[model samples]
Structures are given as structure tokens and as C-alpha cells.
Target: MSRILLVYTGGTIGMIKNPETGALTAFNFDELLSNIPELRLLEHKISTVSFEEPVDSSDMDISDYIKLAELIEVHFEDYDGFVVLHGSDTMSYTASAISFMFENLKKPIIFTGSQLPIGDLRTDAKENLITSIQLAGLKERGKTVIREVGLYFEYKLYRANRTTKINAEHFEAFESSNFPPIAESGVNLKINHEKLIKPNLRKKMLVHKSLNDDIMVLKLFPGLSQQTLSYLFKMPHIKGVILETFGSGNAKTDDWFVSLLESLIERGVYIVNVTQCVGGAVHMGKYATSERLKRLGVISGGDMTTEAAVAKMMYLLDKNLGPKVFKTIFETSLRGEMN
Candidate 1:
């Protein structure tokens, strides 16, 4: 039987309603099988490991991501696949970070969570949890079907780094604006084989745990003051910045603005230009406004979501590469996060 490991890192899906107060409280993973007995019907041996103190997704940080990576590394050879139960709010961030951490991953690492507590009568938790596990366990001829990190929710399986939580009140909370869904589920689970990421099974899995979070995301707006820009760029220890620009990566061409950015680049701070539009890539020189940014050595985040860009920057910064090398790799698609 296939063995699947459920790593619960805390989320709405693991909460139970209290009988007296009606407030939700963290539930025990030991009761998972009993709570959802349908799991027994699957032809897989399911096991779980949860955090000692369940962390709210808001508090999730780089250390927690490293801890998760270490957990999977320890049990890598024993399990066929792994499912991470994470909160929907920051699921994209955590999922994107973990995707970069694991290199040459040959097994499925699916992240999933629910909008409501599992104990709620109208909860969408059961379906998400069950389907996520099934997707994780899916294999073909002794080979895993999905060999990369994915986020599963509302009958859709998306590349983890491509996903963004787009809703707060709806059951379908996540969306991959730039990329297509890897798989879909209804009466049948349909795997889009062509869209799945192909891993090099010949290479051993390498986990990168060192992530530098000394980065900032600066969203550009009309008439953004030089004072504000100066303050941000002058901030000490700010190693990188994800500049969320206008459509097709357009930004102010004001001389001061361009000069400030150039000054930062000269100071060894990497700046990446990403589009604010949800569904488009950054074309740095497509317009005159962005041309100066291109000339100033700003890297283009082509069709990459902000979450993915942030995670990618963190992963790359830890490598301590030179400015030119860093720009080249940042523009390249690492872990299929960008085009």
C-alpha cells in the first residue's frame, strides 16, 4: 500500500467547535481517522505529524518553513507522498517557499486547507482534505504522478507557487492567475499530464533551508513621493525589493525616481520589477515609462506572482551571488515559478 504522510502545520481545517462556547479550538490529529472514517477506504496507509503548538498562519515565518522541510527530509524515503495542512491566508507564501526549498523533488507535496472549521456543519474541509490525500497518493507504474509542490482546493490542483488566495468568504479561495491548473476533480480526478512539472529522478533531493527575509515589496503608484521612496531604499539591511509596477511593468520615469533606483542598485541591492496586474508578465521595455527601469538594471519578474517573487528572492539572496549573476537567475524560471 502507498504510504502518505499528513503534515499538519495548523489551519482552519484542524479546528473543532466547542460544545459550550461554540468557539473553534485546535483538534487532535489522532482523531483524524475517526472523524473522517472514509480515509480507511482508500488503498493507502495514512499517517500524520503535527506541530507541537499549532501556529496560526499569520505567524508562519522562514524558520517554520525550514522546520517543515527538515520534517520531510527525515521521512523522505519512507513515504510515497506528503500533504501539508496549512491555513488558506498565507498558504501561497508557505507553499511557494517550500517549493524552492526542495530541489529535484520526485514525490508530490500538496498543500491544502479549508475556509471553515472541520467541525462546522457547512465546512468544506472534508472534501479538500480527502481529495488532497488522494492526489498525493496517485502514482503511475510505480512513479508518482505529481513530482512538484501543489495547492489543492475546491476540486482544483494548482502549482503551489502559482497560487494566490483570492477569496475570504468563498469555498474557492485560491487562484493561479498566470498559470493553468495542474489537475481538476469532479466525478473523476483529471490529471493534466502535460502541465505537471517533470523532475530529474536521477538527482538526489536537495533541501535548501537558508532563506534571507531582509526583503521588501514596494508597490508603485502615481505621485509616490521621493521622500517615501528615499526612506524605503535607505532602510538598513534591505537586501532586495520586489517593485510592483503598473501594467506590463510600467513605472514612473521621473528622473529622481530612476536615479534613486539606480543608486540602490549601485549599493548592491537587487530590485525586481513585477506587474501589479494579476494575469500578466513584466515586459520591462514595452513602454517608455519602464524603459529607464530596464536601463537601470532592474530585473524583470516575468509573469510571476508576488508571493512567488518574494520566495524566489529569499532563496536567491541566501546564495550570495553577484549582481549580474543574481539578475540572470532571477529572470530564469527556477522551480517553474516563472516563464
Candidate 2:
């Protein structure tokens, strides 16, 4: 039997409606198997752990992320896989951070949660939890099929760093425009081997706990003032910026805008150009507007989601790389976050 660790960091999946107040509240993980007895049928050795205090996904921070990595590190050898319960609101961010946290991962770390409280009659939690556990425990020929961090929702498994929560009300809250689903759940669990990341099992896993949250995302829009742009780039501790530009990474070619970017780049502020479109890669020099940005040493976040871009920026900034090397590494795919 496969041993799986169900790490409940708290989210809608662990909520139960209050009979008197109608407010949803967190329940203990010890009651999980009893609440959903169908889990027993899977016949896997399941172990669970929960945070001391439940936190809403919106309240999650870097400390919570570090705790999660520490938990996995402590229990790394005891479990075959891990299933993380997180809020859909910040699931992509957490998952993206975790993807960069662990190096040479050899087992699955599948994140899942629900839109409604698990105790609700029409809750999507049960299936998500069950399938996530099953996916975690899956192995073929004594080798695990999934060897990376992933987010599973609405019957589809996506690369965690590639995902973005696109909806606030729908069950299908996450989307990976730059990448395809690594696996799907239907009549039978279908694993797309070609899309899944293959890791070298021989390398020992190293967990990165220090994440510099000094980066910011500056999304460009028409009529945005030079004063606002200047203030953002000139912020004291801001180390990097995710420049979300027009389609295909185009931005205004005004002299002021170009000068501000040039000054920031010279000041050692790493800038990455990403597309605002849901489904396209950033080709820096494709248009006249974006060509100048490439000449100014702006890095291209090729087909990367903003969530992943933010996490990657934080991860790389913590390393304190030189300007030239940092630009090269930022454009490269460290954890399959970008193309």
C-alpha cells in the first residue's frame, strides 16, 4: 500500500457550515475519513497534518509557505506522495512558490481545494480530495508517474507554476494558458506523460525557504501617469518588477517611459516583460513598441503566468545574482514555470 500524507493547510475544503449561524468553520482533519468514508475504499495508508490555526487563502504569506516546505522536508522519507489543501484564491501563488522551493522533487505534491464548504450538499471537495490522494499514490513499475508540484481542480491536473486562478465564482477557477493539462480525470485517470516533468531521482531534494517578497507587478495601461510609474520603480526596497504590458509584451514607446526603464535597469532593478493576454508568449522585439524594451535589457517572461512570474522573481532575487547572469537565468525555465 502506498503511504500518502494529506497536509491540510486550511481552505474551503475543510469548512463545515454552522447549524445555528450558517457561517462556515474549519473542522478537524481527524474527522476526514469518517465524514467521507469512501476514502477507505482506496486502501492507501493515509496520514494527515493540519496548521495550528486555520488561515483563509487571502491571508496566506511567505511564512506560511516556508512552514509548508519544512513540513514536507520533515516527512519526506515517510510518504510516497503529498496532497495539499489550500484556498483557491491564492492556490496558484502558493503552488508556484512551492514549485520553486523544492529542487529535484521525486514525488507528487498535488494541491487541491473546493469552491464550497465540504459539508454542503453540492460541495466539490470530496471528489477533489479523493482524486488528489489517488493521484499522489499512483505509481507504475515501482516509479512514480508525477514527480513535480501540480494543482488539481475540475478534473484537470495542471503544472502548479503554469496555473492562474481566472474565476472568483466558478468551480473551474484555475487556468494554464501557456501549458496544457498534465493529467485529466474522467472515466479513467489519464496521465499525459509527454507534458509531465521528469526529474532525476538520483539528486537529493533541496528545499528553498528564503523568498524575497520585495518584488512588485507593474501592469501597464493607457493613460497611466509618468509620476505613478516613477514612484513605483523608485521604491526603496523594490528589487524586481513584472512588467505586464499590452498584447505580445508591447508598451508605450514614449521617451519618458523608455528613460524610466533605462534608469531602473541601470540602478540594478531587474525588469521582466510579460504579456497581459491570457494565452500568448511575450516576444520582446516583435513590435516596434516592444523592440526598445529588449534593447534596454528587459527580460522576457515567455508565456509565463503573472503568478509564476512573481514567484520566480522572488526566488531568483533571494539568490542575489549579477545583472547579466540574472537576466539570463530569469529568461530560462528554472522549474518549468516558463517556456
Candidate 3:
């Protein structure tokens, strides 16, 4: 039987109604099997580990990212695959961060969560949890099937970094617009073999624990304040910025805005230009408005989701690459985050 590790970092999936007050509370992960009796029917050997204190997804930060990476590194060889139960709110960001944290990853790291508390009537937690475990344990010819980070939600499995949480109330909260689902569930689970990532089998898994959170996002809007932009850009502590631009990475052509970005680039601040739209790529030079940004050394984020761009920047920022080197690397596809 395949061995799967269930890492519970807390989410609606782990919550149950308190008998005394009927309020939702995190269930004991130690009693996981008892709480979800259907898990007893699975043939895989499932074991769980949980945080001492459950953290709301809004409170999740880089410290939690390091902790989760360390946990996986410690038991990398003991388990065939891992299933992480995370809050749906920030699940995409966390999953994207984890994807960039590891090198030569050859085992499944399936992140799953639910919209409603597990104890609620018509809760979607049970299916999500059960299917995630099954996917984690899937193998062929003595090798794991999925060799990358994936987010499993509803009936679809998407590349973790490519995903974005598009809805707050719907059970189908996440969407991967630039890429297709690598796998899907129907009457029978199906794997899209052609879409799977193939890692070099020769390299051993390496986990990157160092991540810099000294970056910020500057989203452009109609009549965005130049005063506010100047104030934020003037901050010495800021190392990188994700510039969310208009369709196909277009932006205002005002001299002050252009000068501000140019000055920031000259001062060694890495700026990445990503499209504000969900489905398309940032073709920086395709439009005149974005041509200036391309010439100003703003890295084109291509088809990468904002969550992935943010996580990728954090991971790369810690490496301390030079501006030119960082721009080149960021534009290239690392972990299939871009085309």
C-alpha cells in the first residue's frame, strides 16, 4: 500500500460543529480517520501532521511557508506523496509558494480545501479530502504519477502556481485560466499525461527555505495617484514590485509614471509587468503603451498568474541575483509557470 502524508494546516475541511454551542471549531487531526470514516475504506496508508495552532488563511505568511517546506523536507522519503489541507482563501498563494520552494520534486503535493465546514450539511470537504489522498497515492511502474504541486478543488486538478481564487462564495472558488487542468474527476478519475511535468530523475530534491517578503504589488488603475506611487516607490525597504498593468500589460504613458519606474529600475528595484486580466499573457512590446516598460527593463510575466508571480519573486529575491540576471531568469519558464 502507498504511504500518504496528510498535512493539516487548518481550513474549513478540518472544522466541525461544536455540540455545545453549534459553532464551528477545528477538529482534532489525530482523530482524522474517526471524523471521516470513509477514509478507512481507502487502501493507502494515511498519516497526518498538524500545526499546534490552526491559523486562518489570512494570517498565513512566509514563516508558515518555511515551516511547511521544512516539514516536507524532514519526511521527504518516508511518504510516497503528500496531501495538504489548506484554507481556500489563500490556498493558491501557498501552493504557488510551495511549488517554487522545492527543486527536483518528483512526488505529488496535492493541496485541497472546502467551501463549507466539514460538518455542515452538503459540505464538499469529504470528497475533496478523499480524492486528494487517492491522487496523492497514484503511481505507475514504481514511480509517482504527478511530479509537481497541484491544487485539487471541486472535480478538477490544476497546476498550483497557475491557479487563482476567483470566487469567495462559490464551491468552485479557484480557476487556472492560462493552463488546462492536468487532471479531472468524473465517474472515474482521469490524468492528462501530456500536461504532467517531467523532472530529471538524476537530481535529488532540494528545498529552499529562504524567501524574502520585502516586495510589494503596484496595481495600475484609471487615474492612479502619482503621489501615492511616489510615496510607495520611495520606500528604501522595498526590493521588488509586481506591476499589475492593463490589457496585455499596457500602462499610463505619463512622464512622471515612466520616470518613477525608470528611477526605481536604475536604483536596483526589480519590477515585473503582469497583465491585470486573468486569461492572457503580458506581451509587453506588442502595444506602444507597454513598449516603454519593456525598454525600461520591466520583466514580462508572460502568462503567469499574479499569485505565481508574487511567489516566484519572493523565492528569487532571496537568491540575490543581479538585476540583469534576475530579469532574464524571471522571464524564463521556471517550473513551467510560464510558456
How many pairs of residues collide in each model?
0, 0, 0
CA shift of 81, model 3, Å: 0.5
lDDT of each: 0.93, 0.92, 0.92
Residue pair clashes in candidate 2:
none
- lDDT of candidate 3 over 1-339, digit per residue (tens): 789999989888889988799999888888888888999999999999998888788889999999999998898899999999999999999999999999889999999999998888889999999999998999889778999999999999999999999998898989999999999988998999999999999998889999999999888999898899999999999989999999999999999999999999888889999989989999988989999998998999999998999999999998979888998999998888988
Error of 3 at 21 (Å): 1.7
Misplaced by over 4 Å in model 2 are none
What's the TM-score of every candidate structure? 0.99, 0.98, 0.98
Model 1, 1-339: lDDT tens per residue?
A: 689999999989999999899988998999888998888888999999998888899999999999999999999999999999999999999999999999989999999999999989899999999999999999889778999999999999999999889999999999999899999999999999998999877988899999999999999888899998898788889999999999999998888999999999998999999889889899988889998989899999999999999999999998979889999999999799987
> How much lDDT does candidate 3 score?
0.92
Residue ranges of candidate 3 with Cα displaced over 4 Å: none
RMSD score of candidate 1 (Å) = 0.8
**299-334 in candidate 2: lDDT tens per residue?**
999999999998888888989799999989988998
